[model samples]
Target: MSGADRIAAGGVTAHENNRPPKIEIHGIERIFLKKNETNGAQESFVALKDVNLKVESGEFVTVVGPSGCGKSTLLFLLSGLASPSRGEILINGDKVTGPALNCGIVLQGYALFPWRSVRKNIEFGLELKSVPKKERKEISDYYINLVDLTGFENHYPYQLSGGMQQRVAIARVLAYDPDVLLMDEPFAAVDAQTRETMQDELLNIWEKTQKTIVLVTHNIEEAIGLADRVAVMSRNPGTIRDVVPVNLPRPRRIGGVRNTPDFQILSHHIWELLQDKGSRGGSGAQSAAVPRVDIGEHIRDDAVI
Candidate 1:
């Protein structure tokens, strides 16, 4: 086991606390073989190294890091779309052998079929399951309303905006009734205003569905605002540097929460951690303490945790 893995293993365990984790990633590593075009020499690139994590049932977790930090790779591992070269992943206490029905994934690209209408797209999964037409329509209608896309059901992907298309994608995933939702930068392509709205929408959906969600994004503010715990990762070998819990009250709106003193403190702390890791060449063996700084007056002193 790697030093980083050892540190992670010693952290709070769900089993130790008598609450089993809904999702557990144990000592995972992903390696890709790259061939040099000039000499045809093959080299092994370590995307992730001995990564460990645990998410309680219905918990919202976000993984954030610089590009090439393997945040998306870890999500892929969890979804069973890609297998780790080492370690094991478990969902609901069962080892993930392949892509299971309990997992639903939403990618950055909308991936909606251009030929299909919004309602039809949302019902695609149910169609695969051979659900009756009336039942499929019922499930699709429920998710459409949940996502606020009720009136746009007959519209096509190109007929809708980027945010709308993404909502359709999310509703389609929910229609499948997966126990967990794995989103890989689902709002990266949307505009700033739309992204914020989508974030709020996603949180509301999470609350309503109560499904365990794991999202990977490069945006620090998005990570902090949407997650109960934000897992900060280092580059190079792509090990998790730290997991910062968002202590802000729930029913949070980005406009309100982002301006809070507590939010600023945690944001700065995470920024420092990322910067420190970059300066140290992304070595997970050495852990550094995050320096807390007071932004200004009017913010709670106890906000810096």
Candidate 2:
């Protein structure tokens, strides 16, 4: 199906009707000026151009692309950490002017404080907001358990494993109660087993919280498995090639779905989209045409998988 048709056919949930998208990117372009080492002259490099996407409230959208495709740059714009040279981004009907508490960002580095215990680290945002100490403890306690880090509340970052540290980072963001969650390669640092475990845990948490999430990843399977729609991007003046809807059933287990025919099909399709030579060009219309077939129709043909 085409991206527009899939969206009209329920890429967004029924309840989101009549509401503005939770996140909207319209005609966005970002440029950076760099000095040439050879001549000491400045040149403008286009990092992203003509990017547009809409993420519904409570939606889990993943952006996937090859390296240097401005995936991280897109996240920074959404978080209001950077501005686009043109176009605009809106969150819940308000234009993103600067950093605000309503959105929380989690990075792959697990930017937890080494000096603080897990409980303290999770409560840091609440403390900055001047939430009462009693209430901060209550909030921290809830998220610690939510991310399954209840027993290790008092442990320091240095004492925990990589996965545990990441959980702490997630709980910390959730404790702030942001309406939107932006993640940049948040699981890339972990072992494969741990990454899958984290993906499952994140889905469980999303089900309970229903926060709108936008995650950026280079891992195709991870992008397909976790998102309601995967926004495939192209590099060299980055642009969203297509937003592919994932029709897989949820309460999804990352490992459980990996070998399924539908999963493989979606994976193969996204892989092809990334690898398609047309994606490297200025226009994405050619690459977007590849997903027009009904994905299920390909399942019966064994060779397709």
Candidate 3:
């Protein structure tokens, strides 16, 4: 949340105006231990602390931070995969207490079954829910095409490339048609070129499906390039530092967006915040402010309750 101004990348491009958020989070916290990471006395780790955020429906929100920060912790909480020790999360005005079917997730690696073909993998969710074969086929085929894997529908996970497998993973989620998409470093395993392609495909799917999205990544550029709003978090016992709106325009392609003036400005601003944290000797107890200069050139202020 440092500088919200123009970036230096290929000269930052101006972004659109900020809008109200769709998903709301308040005073959330999560604690974990190896149960064995420490044998003598399972050492406890507080991964998240008082993380508050709001993501508007259909908005693309990206969470970025250093390793061990609670980015993934927050994602898990939102999807109801993990329970929080404290706080509340609301989706469509209802508080979340457990896993809900409407939330689709695409984690860091492809978790598809090796024995299943692309189409069957996509249909798996439906099968569990008792969706009939005809409807399952319809939904699965639709998503396969949506992810541009129509011709590869019969291919098994072993036959597809890493990138291709990811496509199928996405298609499976698309078939689920979750209103909110939760992705944890979904492209971290792919090479740079393939990563870019996956990012592009993500945008297309998002635009077409209009699903609310929350992506967790350690990459700052990726955060700025894909998110409508980038939420920065502090280290362990993590808390959100800031939520900066990306004003970059639409129909934006990946490479072009990265080189924009706005991207450079925001990237530097965020970089500065990270640097300052190091300089200031960041502890888990960081200030509520995420570093950022607003679009109006006015700085943002906060007081975490």
Point to the candidate with the largest lDDT.
2
**RMSD in angstroms, candidate 3?**
7.5
User: Considering every candidate listed, which one attains the maximal TM-score?
Assistant: 2
Q: How well is each residue in 190-233 modelled by candidate 2, as lDDT tens digits?
A: 98889989999999899889999999988888898899899988
Better of 2 and 3 by lDDT: 2
Q: Count clashes in each candidate, considering only residues at least 3 apart in sequence or on different chains.
A: 0, 0, 27
Error of 3 at 165 (Å): 0.8
For model 2, give the 10-residue run with minimal summed lDDT. Answer: 295-304
**Per-residue lDDT for 50 in model 2?**
95
lDDT for 174 in candidate 1 is 91
The better candidate by TM-score, 2 or 3, is 2
Let me know the TM-score candidate 1 reaches against the reference structure. Answer: 0.86
Give me the overall lDDT of model 1: 0.82
List per-prediction Cα lDDT, in the order shown. 0.82, 0.83, 0.75
lDDT of 3 by residue, 76-159 (tens): 889888888888998777788888887878877979988999999999889988999999999997888888887898899999
lDDT for residue 181 in candidate 2, whole number 0-100: 98
Q: What residue pairs are clashing in model 2?
A: none
What are the per-residue Cα lDDT tens digits for candidate 1 across 53-101?
A: 9998888999987777799999899999999999999999999988999
Better of 1 and 3 by TM-score: 1
Which is the better candidate, 1 or 3, if ranked by lDDT? 1
